[model samples]
Target: MADSLGIRVFFIKGPASVLQGLRQAKLSADVDVFVDPARLDELLQALRERGWHDRPVDPDSRTFPKHSVTVHHSEWPCCIDVHFRFPGMEKPPRVCFESLWVNTETIALAGQQMRIPARELGVLFLALHALREPLLPACRQELDYLGELARREGLSEGLLGLAGTTDALAAVRPFLEDLLPKTTSFVWPEASVEWRNRVASHEPGSARVLAILHATWRVKPRMLWGALFPPPEVFLGTNIYADMSMAGRLRQHRARWARFLRAMPRLVRDLRGLKSSGD
Candidate 1:
């Protein structure tokens, strides 16, 4: 369907694409794909027609605009994360897709043509992963893969340059330096206080907080209000607190109200944290 719509799709940020031929890397369960944002509506409609519908998970609620729409098929074990922007970015970069498309390299996978990020961009992507979760064991493994790729492709300088462009060089440099020379038993080290502080400042939680503030106070006040108190149909359509029968719908409404009430304390705490952070 994306081909028919002329929407260029690229596999990104998953074991299938990122670790395709890398034997040592641990495989991930889901596939991540980036599509041109201009054709997002068409792509979404096409997906729905094929029985792939959105599943609003925890991350979707925490991060508003930056969240990817996860779609699933009952028969398929793996899910697809449809992204319009890079994950963890607060806002969409102006030329992200354009540049990525121009730099993309096509490869045949499972007897079908597919696009994946070129070496430089792929390394930059790995660096971004480190920024997102530097402490994870999986991230350390990813860094190992990245280090090998950089050495094999002579992409050290090019990757560093790309990181610099994203203002991520400071956060990503140490990982690359430490991981590149080692081949076994990778020992993860604690990030410096300064680096930790920098990562904290760029947290998506903070971004979500700012989004809520902007929606409620600065602009689009109605957006927040509407989200908090949307019509029943919106819930039904999204399969949130949904019920097929009239009696079930009435019960679901009451249950939803109770759930919201129980969740109020946590919501208040999150809001307070946002205010205290001065975001």
Candidate 2:
């Protein structure tokens, strides 16, 4: 129905809805519907008329206006999240949102305009999801997918471009260091001192840097779980070499995969135990 109606849409999944519609519409025919954030209240009060506030929200949470509906509008019974803001740990400012409009690079997805430095968008999904506690499996899957894509295609040098601006490099240092170890294959194949310095200069919380990290790391399912609800003192300080061996080959890409094959049953049983224990 959205495609037929030529409605621009993005789906979010969570406990609340985010936006009702864009205040600024380029086309008069476009009717951007917001998922009622207080869907329960809206339904109950539908019998008694009242107003619902359609405002922006933190992009990564269900606490926005995009998550109120349980029905699939265009297809079979399902849920979808429509978003105008880039999803992140914190709500991005309105000015940052302008990046999606004029003077921004554009990509077409499902026949809608998606903002560019596309790798950065992919990274945002990975990092924000990683920040969530009691991490959801879906988030991990998304990160894994992004990682694979990054491996196949290189990421934009958003961080590199930010090197001298706003103490940008210094801000995301820890995140860079954290990512440096795990993503060397994808990110560091041709890394030089300048490149490393450029990365190291970033602020820890820079979403751009985090995006680069997510693009480089090949996260296993177990590692995904570990990242979501990590055990104390496990893989602390970015053990990038853990994925490597004494000979500097990716353990999984080498003969170590055979060893892992032998260990698979035990690993599977241990994973089952973890699930049983609710870990």
Candidate 3:
């Protein structure tokens, strides 16, 4: 219906709910479909053709598409999200290769790709768009994804190395600290044990790289929200806003972002020194 109508092609979220929408609606051979510029009308017609126009936006309200749409079905865990472009997202902006996507260094559940720290900085780059416009769903999702990575990865030295900019660390701190450990043991045991020990011993102070760890230890949520959620539009949403129970997680994200930045210049210098010494 969308391609026949001559609309632009956009990728959907590929969640299960979206999948059911495709099957129950009897969409088409292409799992991915193009929608016409007259998307609103076509969507309605598609819903009617499926005899599901009366379905609720989401059978479960919690699963609503951040917006209301007429065709609602049982909470399809995996739903296909169609958009004209990455929709409100900026970095992966080129329209040419729509299906091509890169993976980052995080864990993914089911079919959803996890945005790993460092490996896929493009997601982080896409974040600048959210920083520019706070309310966007993509921006919110990206931040949440980053926060989850920082939590599971434990501000690993390698992860910090990946962020590569002190400013970027500060900008992204709120999301990072959301999962930081209260005590040192909570840190990942998998990475460098020696580095983890070093971070544990270091008191919150300056000059020593320990200062970076210290800053992270002492981060507060308010500080993080102040940095990441800057105002112009005063963005608010059920999904983007951290749930009340999990509200304190953003604190360490600042330091993680900072540590990454701090390490970047040193990393460059060290690489240069290695090359010269090697030469």
TM-score per candidate, chains pooled: 0.61, 0.30, 0.24
lDDT, candidate 1, 1-279, per-residue tens? 677778888887565444444324556677888888777778888999999977655332322334357788887877788877764332245456676677678777767788888767766665666666665677677667767767787777676555545444455656556544455343433443334433443332343334555443554565455544545554554564466577976676677667666766665665576468663
Error of 3 at 38 (Å): 4.9
Q: How close to the true structure is residue 111 of candidate 3, measured as C-alpha lDDT?
A: 62
lDDT tens string, model 3, 174-211? Answer: 33335444452422213222222222221221122322
The worst-scoring run of ten residues by lDDT in candidate 3 lies at 58-67
C-alpha lDDT (0 to 100) for residue 215 of candidate 3: 39
lDDT of 1 at 279: 36
Q: For model 1, how many clashes?
A: 0
Residues 1-279, candidate 2: write the lDDT tens digits.
433334333332221111111111222222222222323344323412333222222232211223232222232232222333322222232433333222223445446654333334334333433433213465455445544444444443443233212122333332333433354543222332222322222222222222233342564444444333333222221331243343544333344345445665655564455358543
State which candidate has the highest TM-score.
1
Candidate 2 Cα lDDT to native: 0.33
Give the clash count for each candidate: 0, 19, 29
Candidate 3 or 2, higher TM-score: 2
| Residue-pair clash count for candidate 3 | 29
- Model 2 TM-score relative to the real fold: 0.30
Candidate lDDT (C-alpha), each = 0.61, 0.33, 0.35
